[model samples]
Target: MRLAPVSLSLVESVLAKPVLDEKGMILVGAGVKLSERMITRLKQLGVSSLYIEDKRTDDIVIVDAVSDETRRSAVNTVYNSMLSMIETERGARRASRPQIGREISRVFQDILADLKANNSGLINLASIFTVDGYLYHHSVNVAILSTALGLAKGYGQKEITEIGVGALLHDIGCTKVPQEILNKPGRYSDLEYELMKKHAEWGYEMLREQDGVSLLSAHIAYQHHERNDGSGYPRGLKGDEIHEYSKIVGMCDVYEALTSKRFHREAFLPHEALEFILGGGTALFDLSLVRLFAKNVAVYPIGMTVKLNTDETAVVVSLNPEYPQRPVVRLLTDEYGRRLDSPYDIDLTKELTMMIVSYNE
Candidate 1:
C-alpha cells in the first residue's frame, strides 16, 4: 500500500506488516491475513494505522536501516534492560552483569552487520513507530544513528560496537522517573524539570556499577545531555569535556526527539527537524557530526506525496544520496489537478529548476 488512510473494512484486503509492542516484541507480522478480530486488537493497542505491502506500492520497498527482526530484537533488549534497572533502583536484586553486557554486544553485532548492508546509509525510522512504544523505539533510532555516525567518523569496528551499545542503553535511567512526569504532555515545572534532568547521572551510575559494562559506555549515558557550549543538563560539561561517543549519541538523541511525535506538539518533518538542529550548530552540538548526520538521513522519504514548485504533484520514488533534498519522483498530476496519462519520473537533482514546495498529505 502507499500509506493511504484506509478504514477498518478496507484493512481486510491488505496484510499486516510486523507491528511491535511497547516492549518491542512483535504484535503482528508480515503476510499474516488480516481479520476483524486482528483489527480490533490493534485498535485496542492504540494502533490506528499500519504499513502493508499491497500492490499499489509493492515495488517501493521501504529499505530499512536494519532488518525488522534486528530492530525489534534491539528494542526488546533495551526495554527489558531498562525495566530491570528500574526494578533494581526500587530495591529489587541486581541481575547478571555479564549477561546484560553480552546481550548489548550481540545487539551491536547484529545492528552493525545490517548498517553495513544498507547502501543509502540514511535510515528511515518512520516505518516502524508505535504510538505506545516511543521509549524503546527512540532507543533503537538513537543507536542506529550513532552507529552510522561512528562509521562515518572512521571508527574501528570495535569502537563502533562500543558506541552502538552505549547509545542503545543511554536512557535506562528514564525507567526510574515518575510515569506521569515522563509522559507529561506539556512543559515541566521547575521542580519536576530538575528531577527529570537527574536521569542522566542516575543512568550513568547504574551502568557503571554493572560488571563487564565499559566505562565509556556508561559515560555516554552520563554525558549525552551535556552540550558543546555548556548549555546542557546534569553536569553542564562543555566542548572537549564531553566524550566523543556522548557527542554522537547526543546529536542523534536530539534529532530523534525533534522528529518524533509527542502529545503536546506535532513532530517536525525530517527537513524541518534538520533545520532546527542546524540552527544549533556548534553551539548545541559538534559541528562536524551535525554535517555528517545531515548526509546520512532522508529528509523526504520514499512513498511520500509532495507538491513541487513547478506546479506539479508527485510521489517520491527514489532517494538521492548526494542531494537528500532533491530525490527522484513520479509525477502524479499537473498544476490544475488533472491526472497524467503516463506518469514519468524526474530526477530532481538534474531538474534543478524544480523544488519540493510542500507535502501533499
Candidate 2:
C-alpha cells in the first residue's frame, strides 16, 4: 500500500521505521517505493530533506545528497575540521609542542560539554555514515564514544579528559605507516603487514619526544590492538598486563571499526558486531569492559524496526537498560492479528516466549 505524501510528524507517528525521502513525508509499506517522487515533490514544496524505508521495509533510508551543493559544503567543512585536527597533532609531534596536549584536552572537554548540554543540533553519530570524512570523523567518534564510556563508569573530569586525549591520538602511529600500504584497496603482502605493525613503535617515539605529555596516552596508539590472550601485535601483553585505559580504548576501537565500512569490507550491523566482540572475550578484549560497553550502548537505537519471535513485527520504541539487546517494542500486530497503540513497550527479555529476529537498520 503506497502512502500519500504526509507531514514528517505523521510519518514519525505511523511508520515502523524511519522513512527516507528528501521531501518532508513518511512513505509506508508499499508506498515506500515512491520515495524518489516524494523527494522531488518535497523539494518542490521547499522541504530540505526527508527519511524513508528500505525496499524490504527493514531499514531507514536517510536521504542526503552526497552531491548536493549544500550537503557537499557541510561535508567539506566537517572533513576539513577533522583534517586540521589531525594535522595540528602531527605538527605537535614534529615540534614537541607543549601547547598541543593542552589543546587536545580542551577539544575533548568541549565535546563533553556539548554532550552534556544535549545540544539541539547534535546528530547521533551512530546514524551517520563515516564514508565522506573517514579519518577525521572516525577520530571524533572514538573520542566521543570513549569519553561517554568513561563518564558512565563514574570517572572524574580529569580522568575523562585524559581518556579523550588518549582516544584522539590513539591512531597517531597510522601517520608513520606508508600511505601506499595504509590505503591499499587490495590485500597487502606479509611484508607490508609487518611494516604496518611498526606504527606502534613509531607512534611511541613521536609522542615520547614531546615534553609533559602523558605517556599512557602515547601507549594507547601502540597497545590498543594488543589482546588479552597475547594474540595481538607488538608485545602481545596478556590479561592485566594491558593497561585499563587501553582495554577500554580497544573495545571502543574495535566496535567502531566493525560498524564502519572500510575498503576491505562493508560495516556489520551493530548487533552482529557486538556478537563478534562477545566472541573475542578474554582472548581479544577484557571481558568486564566489553560487557559494560554492550550494556550502555544501543544495540538497536531509535527509528529501527524488528521482527519478534512471536511471528509478529514491531518498532523499537525505547531502550531497556536492564536488557540492552532486548528492548521494549511496539507490536504492530499480535499473534492473532490485532493492531494496538504505536508506542507499546513489550520487554523482550522478560517475554522469554519472544526474541528479536533481526533489527531494521
Top TM-score hit: 1
lDDT (10s digit) by residue, model 1, range 1-361 = 4433324664565653677777777777767777777777776554545565545355676777888888878888887778777767777666546677888888878989998888864676644455568788888889998998898889997789778888998988887788898888899999999999999988898898887678999999999999999999887899999999999999899988887766556566678888888899999999988899999888887776678997898877789888999999888789888878777889999999999987663
| Candidate 2 deviant stretches above 4 angstroms | 1-93, 114-127, 210-212, 310-313, 331-345
**Per-residue lDDT of candidate 2, residues 231-321 (tens digit):** 8878989898888778888788888777666655656656887899899877898888888777766676544556676767676655666
Going through the candidates in the order shown, the clash numbers are 1, 7
Q: Estimated TM-score per prediction?
A: 0.89, 0.69
Q: Please report, in order, the local distance difference test score of every candidate based on alpha carbons.
A: 0.80, 0.59
Clashes (candidate 2): 7
